[model samples]
Target: MPFFTVIIPLYNKEKYISNAIKSILNQTFTDFEVLIVNDCSTDNSIKIATEFESEKIRIIHHEKNKGLAATRNTGIKNAKANYVAFLDADDLWKPHFLEKIFNLIQNFSEARIFGTNYEEIWDETVKMPHNNSDSLPKDFVGYLNFFKINIKQGIYNHGSVCIHKEVFEKAGYYNENIQLSQDLDFNIRANYHFKLAYDASVQMSYFMQTDNQLTRSSIVNKTIPNYDAYEEWAKSNPDLKKYIDFERYVLGKRLKKNNDSRWKDMIAPIEAKNLNWKQNVLLKLPSSALNLVDKIKLLLLKVGVKPSTY
Candidate 1:
């Protein structure tokens, strides 16, 4: 049996599907199968995906359109390997991505989740996220304090992480109710139950400028994760509570700018100590002021100056 089952959730990503498939094909560690779960693409995505024929690649077609979370759940159910790795149809992995993750599995057998650092690509610019890996040793391979490290910038992306199948059995499958932040909901549960093996090596590229990107959509239309579900547990776990508070602060900012009443509920449970002085001040600002701040932030970003999201 293959050591890993690489699951690529596909929709209408025809322009980048070839590169995504090619990256998997070029992996140095070849004992893996590729499953492309197609969620009823209207474009030539399926056609392009089928052009590269190989025994290791299998394309599963859904009869109708389901969202990203459901598409991923389909891949998990169909996966044949004990370890499942997810790569979006628009992302690309380095040749050694699987090799490094395989090494992590051998070294940290107790960990159910394994991840590597990745670079974010936005048009011609490539930037590393502000993760908590700076103090770690080079080529670090060890279990991570998932919530603690994730409080600043997330160390793992959907494309850079590999999960043991048992994680799904215990922590549960991806939440299909929400179209967005499903990964966050699943990660909170998984990290709470299992240790995450992390290799502090950049082994993947997440393309942020892909066509049909769901993240580009407005915040009001999407169903955000129910942070209240973990409220009881977070009360005792400081790291998890702080992590959730940061998320609340970020989402609350967007909701406040949109003048959505849901913003109040989002930030109601957050502890004041968890938020910084700037975050507290910003929360009280009117929607028009928040909109002006957003425009200024965007302008700064264009000039290569990145203001902190907090």
Candidate 2:
């Protein structure tokens, strides 16, 4: 049984950390080490983690709060296993998570990274039969370059990902410069050299809450898939250039980044609650008196305020 390093990059997620750690401990395949990177959490998350007192559990704390990407990089550096896996503090994986993935990787050792389906839990809703299938759509490689289908269609989730340690080292660690879309950039960078795979058997749960998570304010901050990173990935993807429409999309994002005009260039994910116009205006919304206008607009819109299209 190959050992796996389960890395969790945490930041003040006291309310959720115990549950996240417990989920991994409960896994059917227990041959794993849990590395919790504490990015200067103000909450009692560190205390709770320390109380575990398990040799298998290691905690690395930063004096100052570094963001998610940097924290994960820290965990990666500390990892001591052939395989590296990641779990966000807010998500949960099934008991068979590691067992199933291990079997798949044992069969397909050539694949550098693998991802599985996740049950997206939000607003009292649970999307079941989450794991779709293993085969990437025949044209998936094209989408892999710049996310025309995979990201937009929710074909995979990052929470259920596992990759080789050497792959992480060879491809370079996650981009610390990226605030919002570091995952996208890292995956794109990894894809350049690694053979990616999807296993529908492994299951995880993504609890979508209206808290400090990246999804909540992605549009306002443009971080989920950072427009800047998006532009960089799009322009550099040779495969995307082959498809005329995708080529245009890549060029558009590239232009947006070049001008630093993400306000006009980046489009929020369709599933995001924040509307296009709202995100556009709120990006530049000042924290002082200027926010009152946006607050009022949000309130009025919720109360059925509408006007003819300008």
Candidate 3:
């Protein structure tokens, strides 16, 4: 059996699929299989994936279009290895990604989930390191305080994570019903049940410029995770409560900006003490004003100033 099963959930990413596949094929550690789960791509994505001649590659086609969560679940169900690593069709891994992950697995056998740091590519040129990198302890490599470290921004991107197959059995599969924040939902559940072995070395690239990227989509049409489901459990867990509140703050901003009636319910559970004066002020801003703020934030991003709600 392969040591790892790299699952790339595909849709219509024909332009970047070849690079994504090549990144995996060039991994320094070759004891892995690649599964490309195509979610009924009308584009030439499937054909492009098949053109790869490696015996390690396999493509699984869905009869109809399924969203990202379901596509990922399909990959998990079909995976043959003991460990599963997810790389979105548009993301690229460094050649030594699997090698470092293998080392993490050997060193932290008790951790069911493992992840490495990654950089985000903007405009296909500007590479931005995750905000959490500066806060990480020097030479950090071990079990992480998942909630504590991820409060500002998640330390690991989807492409940088490797999970033991058994984690799905214990924490549950990705929530198919959630169209947005499904990863955060799954990670919350997984962190609640198991320790996450993390390497603070950047081993992957998450291209933010890709077309149809979920983060760039409008939140009005999507279903945000029902964080209320974990409300009861988070009551006693301060770290988890803070983490969920931060997420609520983020989603609430979108809800408010869209003038969605659900905004009230989204932020209602959050304690005022958890939010700072700036967040409170932003929450009260009218939709037009919030939109202006978003534009300003984008301008700042373009100028290389990374702004955050915190």
What C-alpha lDDT values do all the predictions have?
0.86, 0.63, 0.87
> What order do you get sorting by lDDT, best first?
3, 1, 2
TM-score of 1: 0.93
Ranking by TM-score: 3, 1, 2
lDDT of 1 by residue, 170-259 (tens): 999999988667888999999999989998888999875323232355678678999889988898999999989988888887888877
**Per-residue lDDT tens digits of candidate 2, residues 1-310?**
3389999988887888889999999999989999999999888988888877478988998888879889998988888888889998878899988886787677776787876656766432434433232345422221133243342324556678888887887888887776765776676667667776666543788875323221233234344344343444446663432222222233333334334455344433222222234433434443343334434534443444421110
lDDT of 2 at 203: 76
Cα-lDDT of candidate 3: 0.87
TM-scores, in order shown? 0.93, 0.69, 0.95
Candidate 1 residue pairs in clash (backbone atoms < 3 Å)? none
Residue by residue across 56-75, what tens digits does model 3's lDDT show?
88889899998999999999
In model 3, the runs with Cα more than 4 Å from the true position are 210-216
